[model samples]
Target: MIWSVISLLMPFNLEVMVNQGYLAERSGYWGFLLQHPLNSLFEGGLVHLWFLPALMIAVAIMALLIRQQKTHWMLPIAIGLYLYGEFAGSSAVVTGMSAPIYTRNGPFFSTLFVVVGYLIRERHILWQSRSALLLAMLGMAFHFVEAYGLHQYGQVFNTNDYLFGTTLWAIGLFLFLLAKPDLGRKPWGFSLSQSILGFYVSHLLVVIMMMNLARFLGLAGLEKDTLVLFGTLLTTYLLVKGLERTPLKHLLFR
Candidate 1:
């Protein structure tokens, strides 16, 4: 709701993802959340805001399965749904046809990862750093392999969203982070960690503003993505730091 209101203050309808041309079908949808209203915001209604709805749906599905004592079916069901989502959304890479609905905005992507996280906690699974690193490396390698296959044989040069390796990569990375609880305990590290969510939900507005400013200043070459990335980080960091000391932090940032 905050984003719905706050995002409107930016020139987001003129975002790169919408005007970039590749995601034309997606643009009519929102460029990204380019969008409906509060009821369907989860279906990419507010672009980056899609995660909230996806997460809620995935968790609700997981809860239902748990309540029914169908815990064993979670992983399998999640995998099946993920496959359906990948093919449904990225089929253009093979059949040259796009699905009517953006499958990524559906429960397909979030379910498996959510189920995996719950299972790890419910089953008390633990991973050593070395083992987790190996899995992470393997997942990274699988991504390269999948990209190669898509370029060589699939209809497109790049695959949409997730390849099979995507889930594996995410799980491995999550586990790696879990295995290192104290890895980022330094003052700067802790500060950055705390400000992550702040950066995430606020960065789009900053980027949009930055891009518009760059264009106005004829600083296109200078404000390329790398520059924009650092600029957004710096801007958000300052705002987050100040907000952390205020009451509005609870509502707008914290």
Candidate 2:
């Protein structure tokens, strides 16, 4: 909701080409103000905002299946859908078709991981042992190999997330994390946690600003990236901290 409002107020500038010609420049402020909220709701107005809606759709489907006592069907269905999506959606070699509103393979691609998460939670899958951690590392290594091989063969898609290797790696890593002992609460933990959502949402904007700042200062290569990274993080942290004192904090960070 906050993002939708932000999109309406400050829609990111974009350029589109049509008929091998660039669109003529015009004042888009009012048009974007009218369209951005709807775009944010359906068409991923700010690109990163796509995650929320896609995850919502995926979770809603899973919840429905669970409510109907059909949990057993979820894994098979999710796996099948993921495979189909990999072969026929967005970066597919066959169709190369994607839903414009959701952007490149949205809920269908996300559903697989969501289902995996659900299974891990409900089934108590654990990976605390040394052997499990070793296996997880091996799985990640194999996924890297698989991705490289696919890229070499020109069969790789938009991302490795659709591949079985990635699924294995994700599951292994998640289990490994789950097996770790919890860190006891710290004095700054609550404040840090509250700032995370704001940080995630605002960091991209900070990075863009920092990129221009770096360029303006004539920084290049790794130095520029490092400066941008730390600069954005620090700026976002401070911004979140300051916003926390205002009533609008909940709208931005919640």
Candidate 3:
């Protein structure tokens, strides 16, 4: 939260940065910072912060269910909720209502994945098997097909679609990782993991800055994107490593 707030206070504005021609309408730094707490709390705020609150809610719900010895029912209930979300999206055509409500409703939309994670952890499900790999591949293929179908129908593809096949893909990939014995033993693994949160919070600002720099240098398309990605990653990694040894680490990362 602290990192997110600090990032939002930066001069960079994603809304203006992306719009390019609308830079004149960008909010002043103080105004943007003041408005961001509300936006962050309600509208996901600063790119990826939505995952934090969404995960919080999902984890709370899972904790309550587990505490009540309702673990067996959790997965089934989550599946049913996911299916309802999907149906709600489809029904938008007939009801004249928005189809992607579930996506926007972070708590509800995030529950299924949270439940899946809990089930996997509690059951000690392993993903190293050949069957799991094949299933994961199939799930990814199905996710693409579903996404394409949604695009063809002129409806926005949202989280419900992801919940369908993407969920399976994630499960398979997660299991596959679990099946591996030496996945996190790399020399840089500890530093990388420690710095990951900082990277997540800071990378968007770096990307925005790098993209603008790229454009100013006459770069375009893939060249711009590649530069932005690599530049952001390198800068964020260094920033996190530097901060890790400083007094500000607690304020920024803890």
- Residue pairs in collision within model 2: none
Superior candidate under lDDT, 1 versus 2: 1
lDDT of 2 by residue, 1-254 (tens): 67645644442332222222322212354445345454455534355666677788789889999999999989888887777665554335444654433233356667888999988888888876565667767777876776676676565534655555666767776777787746435768876876777876777766766876786688999999899989998998888789889998877877
> How would you encode candidate 1's per-residue C-alpha lDDT over 46-108 as one tens digit per residue?
467667778888999999998999989999999998888877666446655454556777688
What is candidate 3's lDDT per residue for 172-232, written digit by digit as tens?
Answer: 8777777875878887897588787777776777787897688678899899888988988
When summed lDDT is taken over every stretch of 10 residues in candidate 2, the lowest stretch is: 11-20
TM-score of each: 0.80, 0.76, 0.79
Candidate 2 lDDT (Cα, whole model)? 0.67
Q: Which runs of model 2 end up more than 4 angstroms from their true locations? A: 7-43, 89-91, 94-105, 155-161, 183-190
Candidate 2: Cα lDDT at 141: 82
Q: Model 1 residue 17 lDDT?
A: 42
TM-score of decoy 3: 0.79
Off by over 4 Å in 1: 13-40, 43-45, 95-98, 153-159, 223-226
Model 2 scores a TM of: 0.76
**All predictions: root-mean-square deviation over Cα?**
5.3, 5.5, 4.5
**How many clashing residue pairs, candidate 2?**
0
